[model samples]
Target chain A: MADLLQTPLYDFHVEKGAKLVPFAGYEMPVQYPLGVMNEHKHCRAKAGLFDVSHMGQVLLTPKSGNIEDACLALETLVPMDICALKPGRQRYAFFTNDNGGILDDLMVANRGDHLFLVVNAACKDADIAHMKNKISDTCEITVVDDRALVALQGPDAETVLSALIPAVADYKFMDVAIVDYDGMELWISRSGYTGEDGYEISVPADNASVFVSKLSENELVEPIGLGARDSLRLEGGLCLYGNDIDETTTPVEAALTWAIQKARRTGGDREGGFPGAEEVLAQFENGAPRKRAGLLPEGRAPMRAGTKLFSSENSSDEIGEITSGGFGPSVNGPVSMGYLSTEYSAEGTKVFAELRGKRLPAIVTKMPFVAANFKR
Target chain B: MKYTEEHEWLKPEGDVVIVGITQHAADALGELVFVELPEVGTEVEKGEEIVVIESVKAASDITAPLDGEITEVNQDIVDTPTLVNEDPTAAAWFFKMKLKDASEMDGLMDEDAYKALID
Candidate 1:
């Protein structure tokens, strides 16, 4: 705890009565005075501000000064169609290992001249090193340390953001732009993990507090913390890197194949080039043995992570294990996601989770327990 | 009324005592989502886990404060768990038990001692 780092908005979070907890070597707010339940609901209805500065932000500049060179260089590492990514858009991607297991899930944005990436906090250092060791010859990797990233998410996010920066009104989901605000360049991305219409803004570290303060002033915006952030993403059916998907889990098994564009698939222009391309492409052609599925417990009791799932109430054979589970405030019940045997992965299938020595009944349901509201 | 270091409160009514958590414990646990109480006829020893509580953040257990036989259980809190957060000491009373030894209450903390412990 003594060596834990603080983000740019540390003092601001303290001022707002945040319950700070250690996360990925950083002292982050687990929840504010609003608590996790209400904070989660607020993010779905109105707007909630989140401090995401703990995540890693890196820029990739091409050595040949051609953005296509950097994109082609990145293709050697990830399986995404980075070369076809437009200038003002971001795509979800992951760094796959030689075994097809995901190193970390990340966002890759083509910022015109350079590629901007945001990786998970715990894997930031390793992700940067992996890129440098692999693609440094073709592209110069620069870690952006002097910026603070924050997410403003929910139904009212557009109304709240457009008021501050009028140009944001023209942007839709996954759109990225560098806009001027009070002579400062703010990198804004119309994307978030909450399955809501929102924006992830990167402000200079020195002005981070001021920008957050301005957002907090809005009647619709309340400062949210990590607790609510986790619940919101859980309800949105989004994966938490270390929880749902990890070094041992591949994108196909995690049910994230939708993020892999057609150009990177089998028989496409850039097929079988990235790490683990053999296994990943094979899984695409023939389904993976195990697949991630959503779980809706019949009772109010949450069947949390590490809970073993059986095919039936009295069965000793384990079929799966819960990866993420908790009370979903919006759904008013326990919602969860986990890897299940391909046989039990279909929606509406009945499964049993062992909790406290009792086997609880649950149904395999479609995810996004709460429907997404992104402005497409 | 007596309190335990585990944040439970006991109000003696004749040979039976009503059990529930304190407001401080409720606040610390945040919003409650589920409660699992013991069977009414079950006999529980002191320090034995008897009840399970789940909040949005995580799940926790409530142990038997003293050796006793559960005489009754609160089904309301089991249905609507948020009652524990709204009125932990009153309406959210988890159960009532007949003590195996009434003298066990003598060693518990008083209101002031419990306040000092929480503070």
Candidate 2:
């Protein structure tokens, strides 16, 4: 346990009655004294602050005036359209290995001056090394390890933030801005993991604690932990890095094709350049062998990752595996998401999930298993 | 006749020894979101795990109160987890078993003794 890292707010969380547990090699709060269901529902209804300081933040700039050339160089690595990203907007991207498996998924925000990236905590070190090797002297990549990240998420996030930092409300969804709240400056992004209107603020490590404490001053804001974050993201049909996605699952198979730009799908202009481009392109044209599907479980028996998925029509022959699942507090029932064969991937299609020794009835459904209320 | 350090409580009735988690154990677990029950007729040793209880954060195993063969198991506790948080000493019994370790029961703690053990 000594090997696991702690965030800047680690001690603060312990003081606030947070039950810290190990996750992704970090000692994070699984829930507070209030509990998981309450924390989850609170974020959907009001505002909740999450200490995401464990995520990696990096800064990158073009070698010359050739930012597009630099973006293309990186675009050769991920399938996302880096060249098409507008200033102040962020896009999702995935890293693929040689066999079309996903390495990790992250958000790359065009923070006007350069680019601000938020990658998974578990993969950050390796991801940084990979970026350093692929990117040359033509581009500069710097790890902003000195910064601490906090997310204020929910429907009233903007209202609460605008009261403290007036200019924050001006940005639209997926847009980012750098602003001054009181005397300290923050790089604020109108984005978050919970399917609600929210803001992710990046502040200097020294000020993160005080700044987060200041936000918690509001009666509406509570400090949320990783447990609620996991269930909340899962209820929103979002994937966990090691569970839902890994070095063995491809972006196309995971139903993340929406992240890939249309032009990039055909490998237009610059072709066959990225890792697994050949295999990824073929799956893009021919359709993938398996696809991610949301499961609405028949009863309250919560299915978890690695549980076998089957179809009763075929005598319970295994068809897939549940990658992430739990009782969705807002939905007031059990929900799950995982990959399934193409023959059983259609939304509304009937399937069965093996729970304990019995086969529980399940049906394919559209994602965000919980409806999203993000501010457009 | 007794309990384990894990706070599983047992009371023998003829051949069957009724089992449930202790109030001390339930208080620490908090909110009792999920409970995993053992099947009927399963033989359990004196120190073996027989049932599982999960709060939101972690999972804990309830060891066999005494070596026994499960005769009856509770389905109501599985349906309503909060019973463990509410009436842990009564309606929250995990199962009823034929005590195979009746001679070993003297080693287990009583309610007052269990409370003192925590202190």
Candidate 3:
């Protein structure tokens, strides 16, 4: 068994009687005493506080006047439009490798003069190493592990955030801001994994306890663990990094081609060379063989990951596999998303998943099974 | 009344045995939220895990006390899991299974013996 890692809020979780479970090498709270179902419903109805401090936070600043050149260089790694990223804004992007495979999907925020990146904890070391090797020494890359990440998510998240700072409300979706919450400075982003109106606040590790305690003091807020976090993100149609995308799946195959700008993808605007460019550009022209699509199982039963796929209502040849699947509390039903054959990736297309000793019927649907409530 | 080492408490009820979780087990499980009971007529071997009871924190398997076929199931706990917390031995009766080996209960720990196990 691997050794379990502890977050800055680890003691606070133990104090709240949280059931700690090993996840991504960290001994994180799987659920509190209130359980996954209740914690999930609480996030949808009221507000939920999550300790995401396990994710790595990094800062990068250009050497002199090469911010744009550096931004373009960084864009070569991920398919997202980094050059267009305005100051005080954030964008979702994946760090793709030479084969167009996702090294890790991360949130890259352009913080005024510098850059703020939040990557998955499990893949942070590899990501930093890869960035350091690829970028010029002119760029400054510093990992901010001293911060404890906390997310206040829900419709009332804004209300609590507004109380913290009046100017926070002005920030739009995927935007970042550095604000002083009392005496501690925090990097605030209007981004969350739960697909709700929420903010991911990065507080110094030393100040995490008091920050979390004070945040929970609000009557509307409650501590949520990874159990509810999974269910919530499942409902939101968000995929887990290791399960959904890995070193083999590309941006085009994952249906994230929107992140790649046309100029960079094609040779028209001096097709800047990048890793997996040839394969990705080819897939852009002649579509990918498989694509990511949402699955709506016919019955109430959830179609979990690794569940084999068939085309018949009962039995047929195998086609694809479920990547992420679970019960969606808001939908009050089970929903799933997975990679499917391009021929069957259309919305409303019928499909079947082979659950334990049974064939569960499903239909392909558009993503965001639960409507996004971004404070745009 | 006697309890199996697996934490199942059973009471003689005519030709069937009424089963409930032990107080010690309920307390350790924290708050009960959902209970998945086996269907009637389902055959269960002695010491086999026959029920899936989920609490606020985690889901646990409740093992069968003796070899038997389920005669009846209690649906009340499906909606009200706290009944196990309130009265685990009586009001929270899980199900009744007709015994294939009636002498199995004799080998289980009696009330005093079970109390010692808890202590």
Candidate 4:
């Protein structure tokens, strides 16, 4: 096997008795001694610290010294209203390919001088190459490799974080700020992937272990692992890039139309100038052939990814395939999401997942099986 | 007690044998949320998938150790799946099966050999 890369907190994770597994070219902790279910429940009720340092962080600066030029260049790559994004605010966006499929989903923060981007670890290199080849002459892209990112999430996150930086309590959801912690510069954002009220802290790589230790010192905070992270995001109805929204899946087909703001939609001011706008906007007028929907299995057996879904009315006919599925610790049952035929995408539509040679009964239910607790 | 490379353990009691996953397997799998066992009176062959154990992260299938007919299955583990994590080799035994061939036990590994293989 190839040697896996290590994050800044690799030693800390080993010290905490975390089960390490290979993920996205890094050996990351999948769970701790407390186990995945307990860690998942802890994050929902209290605060859980996660090491997300493997994600790529980049700074996009316009060589012309005009922030508008940077936004315009970004608009050509994504379908979001980058010009409308306010300073110090972050938005979720994806890089759309020529065919309207998603190259990668990312979080874009509009800083006053430059744009801050956080991309998925597995797709970062390709995303950088694509951006550089397309817009490097207009905008200078710098990969920030000296920084490490960590997330503190859950219902008690704000309260726990407030103890360290009291001013953080004033920040609302999706707010970003550059703060100083004991002479160390910290880029803190009140946003996370866990669907909980949380903060993502980008700190210097050298200080990451110290920052994580200080946060974990709080009584309510525990070190969570990737296993619970996946379960939490699954319950929140969030899509995993490679699994749920890949290069073959468009935002509209993945039910992520909300990420595309009103300004970029039809009959709006911008009127779709981004890549793949023709095909993507047309899906708004006429719905796509298939749509991503939540699946609730009737029995305890989980319908895992790649499992084929069949229409219950006619068991022999395959309708779709499960893109992501697993046991939701918070919901206390199996929750899954997959694309189904448009006709069978309605809520309460009966379906069957073929698992181990048996057609397990399932139903199309509303997504976000567990309610999001974001502090909006 | 005999062990299989797939991490299942068997304890023979006359023609009927008790079966469960090894503690090593449970530890590697983390907290189990669900367990799907084979129906009683069903015939199973060696290396066939007999049970499925699911954790919050992923699911794994437990294969049959040798050809057998399932005599009984543990309903407790199905209701409370974490029992496998708490005591995989003893209280959390998945099922009891009537062995088809007694000589099949010679092909399994002992505790020391199994420990060496995992370590």
Candidate 5:
């Protein structure tokens, strides 16, 4: 096994009573003394700070100094409308293979002169390699290794963050800003995976500790770990890369068609040019065979990941399996998300999950099991 | 009271023994959100999986520590699982069972041995 790497806030996490665990090649705090349940509730009620520096941050610059060239070049890899993305705005995107399966889901921001992207930690190396192998001839791909990424999530995130970087208050959801603080450049974005309104900030490595420390002085901000992070995102109905959607799961099957802008669809301005355009665009018009659905277990026992799903109580045929399942502290019950056959994927349909040799009833429901609080 | 390597505690009271997880096990599992206990009056052998516990992070199972027939199961932990975190060895006792062979209790670890194992 390779030695696990520590983030810039490693010492800070230890001092704050974090339970460090190995995750995606990094020694990340899985939870603090505050525990996962309270940390999840705290993020919904107030604010929670999460260390996400292990994720890959990359910059793509066009050699011709033209942003349009870079956007068009990137459009060939992802199915989103990169050409229409305005400056200082970020959009969700994913790379697809020839089979229409997702390679990785990422956030791409138009940073005026260059395009900035944040990819998943486990898929970072492969994503960067794919980019370099495909578009390096037209654009310069630079791996950003000198910054620490942190997310301040919850209802109080705006008020708490604006006090430190005053300009953050003006940025709405999905808007990005470059701010100068203490002789360092901080990249801030008003977006997060947790349904709450918040910001994901990229701070220079040298000043990460002090920057996070200053934010923690606020009573509303608590240091959350990977445990709460998973639960919060699960409750928000957002997809975790490997768990919810993987190499075999397509954007249409994953219920991520919303991320695919209309311009990339069958009858749009720039259509059918991405990697799996033929298969993906077809799924958009004629629905996919199976799709992701939200599951609310009737009982308290959580139907964890990999639990098999059946159409009826006594059916022996397996229809699908749960991707993510856990206790939603905000909803005060067990909430889950999984893929099901299109016929069984309706909001009010009944499905049975097999647990401990017994089939338990679950209802297919519309998700964001907790309502989203993003600032428009 | 006797301890199992799996971190369960057994307290003898006449022919029936009260079974619960130790504080060390509770701390390791974090906050318990749900617990599924076996039915009372069911006969079980040692090491049979009988209890299912779900914390906020993951799900785990607790097995039978010794061969016995379940006499009573704790409904408090099932209704409110966090009680196991607050008072694991006492108020959060999972089930009471009458041992088939009481001599099996002698093979379990004492407090000093359990403490040394955790240390």
Candidate 6:
């Protein structure tokens, strides 16, 4: 624990009575006194401020002083069409290994002069190292370590943000803009992991605490913790990096084909030059053997991670295992995601999860269990 | 009243002893959404898992503190699991059991001893 790092808002979290736990090499707040359930509901109804500063932020600048060159270099690493990404727009993308396995999922924003990236906290070091080893000569990778990211999310997020910066109201989903907040420049993005209308603000570490305090001062805004953050994203059908999507999982198998733009796929100008393009494109044409699907347990009992899944007809035959599962506060029942054999991945397919030595009935349901309210 | 390291509490009320999780356990478990208690008349051994509690985050098992036959179970908690978080010590007792051997209570910690262990 001595090696655990502290975020800029560590003191504020402690003052608010957060239960700190070791996460991604940092002592992060898992939950507050309001409890996970209450905090989850509060976020859906109003707004919840989350300390996401643990996520990695990096800037990529081209050595040739051309943004297109930097975008093309990035295209070699991921399957997304980086050149198609317009300035002040963000897109969801992931790094792929040679075998087509997902290295990490991230957000890529084309910021006119340079590309801004936000990677998962746990995989930031590896992702940065991979990029540097692969493309450092063509594009300079600068890790932005002096910033703290906070997300204000919910149905009322726009209203609350408008009160602070009236210009934010003009921004739509996936929009990114640099705004001046009280003499400090903050990178504001209309994007978040939670499937709600929200904003992720990247602020200077020195100004993070004050900015968070000011945002939380609103009556509708409450400071959320990692516990609720996990449940919220789970209900929203978003994949957790290490759990749902990992080194062994590919973007196609994880049902994230939407993130891969048409320009990079087959029948396009740049048809499949990224890593694992051959395997990925083949999977696209022939289909994957297994697929990630949502699971809805029949009863209130939760089927957690590592729980083995069996065909409803036979208890002895194991077909898959739960990757991420918990009681979804919004769905009011146990929700889970796992890789099932392609035949069993269809919606409403009956399945069984082994829990406490008993085989409980479950159904393959469409995620998210709760509908996303993104301002698309 | 006595407590176990597993956080189950026992109160002697004549022939049958009442059982419930401690307040500390409830707080740590957070707001319980569901509870599955052992059926009445079921015999359970000490250290055997007899109750299952589910929160929004995860599910946990509550073990039996002593060898006993469950004489009664609180149906109120089965209907409203939040009672476990609201008043775990009193109204939300899980079950009442007829002890197979009352001497097992001696191995349990008293209130003050349990407080020290948790603190």
Q: What is the lDDT of residue A55 in candidate 5?
A: 97
* Chain B TM-score for all candidates, comma-separated: 0.98, 0.91, 0.96, 0.97, 0.98, 0.97
Per residue, candidate 4 scores C-alpha lDDT tens digits across A123-233 of 999999999999898899999999999999999999888898998999999999999997778999999988888999999999988888888889999999998999899
Docking outcome class, model 2: acceptable
Model 3: per-residue Cα lDDT over A101-163, one tens digit each:
889999998876777899998999999998898875657888897899999999888888777
Whichever of 1 and 5 has more DockQ, that candidate is: 1
Please write out the lDDT profile of model 6 over residues A1-376, one tens digit for every residue: 7999999999989999999999999999999999999999999999999999999999999999999999999999999999999999999999999889999999999999899999999999999999999989889999999999999999999999889999998898999999998977899999887788999999999998998888988999988999999999999999999999988998889999999999999997899998899999999999998999999999988888899999974568788989999888888878899999889899999999988878899999999889998887
The TM-scores of all predictions, comma-separated, are 0.99, 0.90, 0.89, 0.97, 0.99, 0.98
The number of clashing residue pairs in each candidate reads 0, 0, 0, 0, 0, 0
Better of 1 and 4 by TM-score: 1
Candidate No. with top DockQ: 1
Candidate order (lDDT): 1, 5, 6, 4, 3, 2
Candidate 6 local Cα displacement, residue B9, angstroms: 1.1
Q: Retained native contacts per candidate, as fractions?
A: 0.89, 0.11, 0.11, 0.94, 0.83, 0.78
Clashing pairs in model 4, backbone N/Cα/C closer than 3 A: none
Give the CAPRI class of candidate 1. high
- What Cα-based lDDT does every candidate model obtain? 0.94, 0.83, 0.84, 0.91, 0.94, 0.92
DockQ of candidate 4 relative to the true structure: 0.83
Cα deviation in Å at residue A288, candidate 4?
0.4
Q: What is the C-alpha RMSD of each candidate to the true structure, in Å?
A: 0.8, 2.9, 3.2, 1.5, 0.9, 1.1
Clashing pairs in 2: none
Query: What is the full ranking by DockQ, best candidate first?
Result: 1, 5, 4, 6, 2, 3
Which 10 consecutive residues of model 3 chain A have the lowest summed lDDT? A263-272
- DockQ of each candidate's interface versus the true one? 0.90, 0.33, 0.24, 0.83, 0.89, 0.77
Per-residue C-alpha lDDT of model 2 across residues A1-376, encoded as one tens digit per residue: 8999888888779889998888778898888987787898999899989999999998777778566766776786687788888888988887778888888888888765577788999999988888888876656888998888999999889888988888887888888878877788899888889888899999988888888888988989988988889888988888889999998998889998888887676747555567898898898889998998899887666777787988784475788989988777788777889989999999998888876567878888899978887777
